[model samples]
Target: MDHRFVGIPELTAVPRVAVVVDVMRAFTVAAWAFSRGAERIVLAPTVEEALALKEGRPGWLALKDGAPAAGFDAVNSPGLIRSRDFAGRTLVQKTTAGTVGALAVADAPLVLCASFVVAGPTARYLRAGAAGPVTFVVTGEDGRADEDLACAQYIGAHVSGGRVDPAPYVHRARNSRAAADLGAGRRAGCHPDDVELCLEVDRFPFAMVARREDSLTVLRPVTAPVNPAR
Candidate 1:
């Protein structure tokens, strides 16, 4: 399969397997939520929908909207997700980039949601599928640069069967105007720690896979249920 990294602007050219990356918060938070026992995640295109879902799901929790540059769930920090109890719950998430990007690319045949946390499993899932071009889309702050681009580089390296090198983007990512937006969340208030968490590749063993529905797409973790016997 042909795979390459492209910015959101060039997304139309390669629309088959569009892997949306929002490592710093959106996608990273999604991964963390799932890992914490969130039964399912509904990717809401708008904060309204996210809040609605939270209200509808009874036990469902949400990550609300942040500032102009920042995104939903400034409270949905990695630390919050990592430390909180979601033993039998689910999350309805919305964001400026990650969820929006996934919503925008809902028309694509195979749209995969990814981040550094699930990068390895995401790669394995792609490699195990049919041979087709995969486009790595970075959903940055205001859908621009740094975190998303860095994530794109990370995923791009794996997709191309090369070693991951995020240094180039990391240095540049630190200087991005959107960097602060990404750091607005709780875990991110301490930027360095958040960055380190965001850069930890292959931390998860499953990938969040999405398929188009009537007008929306459904995203859920791709993993075989644990066998109670094994």
Candidate 2:
């Protein structure tokens, strides 16, 4: 199994197994929502599409980042997501990087939505015998999203049969310019606490797998043993 890392611009080269990562609160919020019992999440590339998906759907909730949209249930903040009850409901999520990246590679045979929150479990799921040439899609713009790149490498190291400490990656992400901007209130509609939440390594014990469902890229959590017998 070979692992390749690529940024959003290089998404066209995505392989059979694509791990789309968004660490600065996109996939991290997704992990929290799943942990809170969300049935499934429908990823939309645009905010308009997310709201449209939630429109007239009784059990659907819409969420996005940067300025509240008309029909969104909440911003893409993990703090707000943690406080809400999403049990058995479907979430329609749109983000600048995460959702767009996932949708771009939705045609891949196996697409996993990734963040530090689900990093360990995601790696284990791949190591458990999923077909590869795995590609880690860094949703953060090419060369600028340090947090997403770190997460991709973190998961890559694990999938490569190496015992890599997650502390450095977490530290790198915490100090990333994106995190700095959010913490300093430079980025609106994003919470400062979200940076810490997004950097919580192995916070969830499941990997989020995305599947193409009609026009939506639906993600569902798949749990795997933390330390499977080798």
Candidate 3:
């Protein structure tokens, strides 16, 4: 399968499979939430919509980043997500980049939400099931999210039938401006531990896949073996 990397603006050209990457904390948070037993996550393109989904709904929670929404349970930080008990809960997530990117490619045949935490499993899933071209959507401003781009490269190298050390990519992500902002606590509702949490490669053993469920784009975890002798 041919692997192509594109940014948010190029999403309209996406082919069969589209992987939306947001390592700076959006998809990472989803990874953690799924690992923690979240039943399903609804992707919201806007903070207002996410808040609307949570209204009067039992077992539903809203999570977002940037200026706080009125009823959001928490921010999109993996550090905070790690300790929460999300068992049987449905999360409505609205992020500055990641969720928007995923929703943008909702028309694609297959959509996968990705971060370093689930990169290995995602790559394996693609190798086994993807029959057409795969596109990695880097969900950052101006198509220049260093950490997200690094994660796309890491996963792409694996899917290309070769394995490259993830060290360099991890290093590049750690020193990125986004990492610096989170490390210095400049971003609202973000924790200092989030930088490390987002950079932890292969932390979870499942790939987060998105599917259209009625009017919502829902994400759930799919566990694929590290190496399948197919």
Q: Best-fitting candidate, measured by TM-score? A: 3
Q: Over the stretch 87-122, how does candidate 3's per-residue lDDT look in tens digits?
A: 999999998899989988998898999999999899
**Which lDDT values do the candidates have, in the order given?**
0.67, 0.86, 0.88
TM-score per model over all chains: 0.78, 0.95, 0.96
Candidate 2 residues 1-230, lDDT tens each?
A: 68878888876654789999999878999999999989999998777777778996887999988777677887888866787888999999988889888888888899999999999998898888578589888888673699999999999998887478999988899889889888887876776588888888888889999998886789999987767643
Error of 1 at 3 (Å): 3.0
Q: Which stretches of candidate 3 lie over 4 Å from their true place?
A: none
- Model 1 agreement with the true structure over 1-230: per-residue lDDT tens digits: 57666656566653877888877677877887778787667778777777766776577777733432232333545755576666667677776677877877777778888877787677667766635787777777445677677666666665556355656756665655555554654332333356566666778888898776554466778962222111
The candidate maximizing lDDT is: 3
Q: Which candidate model has the greater TM-score, 1 or 3?
A: 3
RMSD each, Å = 5.4, 1.5, 1.3
Candidate 2, RMSD to the unseen true structure = 1.5
The positional error of residue 76 in candidate 3, measured at the CA in angstroms, is 0.7
Error (Å) of candidate 2 at residue 123 is 0.4
Q: Candidate 3 has which clashing residue pairs, if any?
A: none
Q: Rank the candidates by TM-score, best first.
A: 3, 2, 1
